[model samples]
Target: MKNKFLLLTWLLAVPLLWGGCDKPLFKTDEASIAQPDELPPITTTGEGTFACKINGVNWQRCGGGFLQSSIIGEWHPVYKIFSLQGLRSCEGFDDAVYINAFIDSIGLYPLEAGQYDDFNLECQDVLDQYFLLETADNWVEILNLNTDEFIVSGTFQCTLVHEGCGDTLFITDGRFDYDWAN
Candidate 1:
């Protein structure tokens, strides 16, 4: 009888001894960046929308209260190429994407990773972590090229594997609109 009463008391007292968790705790593996539904639209007016999803997570280029974000590009008429880069800066991430042009037409081009000096799509996330094009599908297609205004607009998608690491990043719905200088 006494043991039964002691067990009941212990169970009742244990509930009171435990503290409450008012704050939310997240694990390192589960700590993913916040995602927003509204991404910048695809435009040819140099809106500079450098955004994509990383492993199904949102990645955007913006002035993250600290570092500034911008898009810089150039087109060489004689070389028949247009190159552009997206510099992204956000809280806890400084990402960048690069696309080097080869053809001067508004068409789809092969952008394979790990290849040397042709049409390529490359990205860097969290430093030393690069997008590998050899793993999955990757390409870039120019939708609009306004030579008069020097605006280059394109859409790109790639499956990037981490160099030296086994992690993968899916860069999807990627688009860019930048005013290039010759």
Candidate 2:
């Protein structure tokens, strides 16, 4: 009899317990804004040295100081028949940068010549796709590789197209030194 009474009491309270809250079940407000971080999804893998310069004096890479790790690695842009981005097959002084993927579907080789390419196209493809250079493209130089390898003292060139302004080619043809990460 006690168990039956207890069961009866529990059953009767369930409806009363859930009755008060009736705020249209659930809803989302599209107009109400969210945080900047909540606005658009920021890429996790979309990290790398995205450097740019209008003239050549002020050069900047992505990640700045806080997010610099993404851009710190041995990377080079190459042009095969089909064009392929290649990463250094050999590991750099720093082991943190891993060659996850290469950019080209087939390896880097001329369709007619069939000559072997130096760097692996697979690695370069991944970098190009991840770090897309949609603006007027230019030869990308491998500035520094870890603490040891650095580019030969030369200023690389780049092309830029400001949104409203047209296109501009930047020439760093002179010579420049690279400062490797300590």
Candidate 3:
């Protein structure tokens, strides 16, 4: 009888210990945004940089470019077209942040500074993939967009949802300035 009781207790405790040892789906390091003095000088040589806070942690990318997608269809006043991607892929994973937006058209829509636009922002790491949660509320402000030079700059903030991990990551103070052609 004593042996049986000991075995039963060991079995229950083993399962509990194993379950308690499970790790979190995602983990982020604590980091702060870079100040103006810390930022690299803006380059005119056509290289672009993207920087943002991921879950309050700082992340930046030095490789990416801007382009426009072909017109898919017409939406009357404004053509229904997608701004081609300017993406920065995260190291060690098939994840990236689609950073900039460029509305390409003849004279239908003028690229205006300080205009807030909804963007399909995405971020993924090894563990999970995240996308913009509130499409309408989450927006990026165009700081500058020069059609002739093909240079664009912007700032953004959004909440990203990871369905697989059942978690959310808030990205804030996002900024990108890139000269598309080099």
TM-score leader: 1
Candidate order (lDDT):
1, 3, 2
List the candidates' TM-scores in order: 0.66, 0.23, 0.48
Please give me the total number of clashing residue pairs in predicted model 2. Answer: 9
Q: Which model is ahead, 1 or 3, in terms of TM-score?
A: 1
Please write out the lDDT profile of model 3 over residues 1-182, one tens digit for every residue.
99999999999998787677555334331222232334344333334655566666655543333222111111121442323233433232222454323354322232211111123223334434455675524655656556567665556666766665566767677665666544
Q: Write the per-residue lDDT of candidate 1 for residues 26-123, one digit (tens) a residue.
A: 32222365567766787877666666665676666765432456666676878876666666555444456666657577999766332111111233
RMSD after CA superposition, every candidate: 8.7, 16.2, 9.7
Instruction: Give lDDT: candidate 2, residue 20.
Output: 75
Clashes of each: 0, 9, 0
Model 1 residue 96 CA deviation in Å: 1.5
Candidate 1 off by > 4 Å = 1-33, 64-67, 112-131
Number of the candidate with higher lDDT, 1 or 3:
1
Which candidate would rank higher by lDDT, 2 or 3? 3
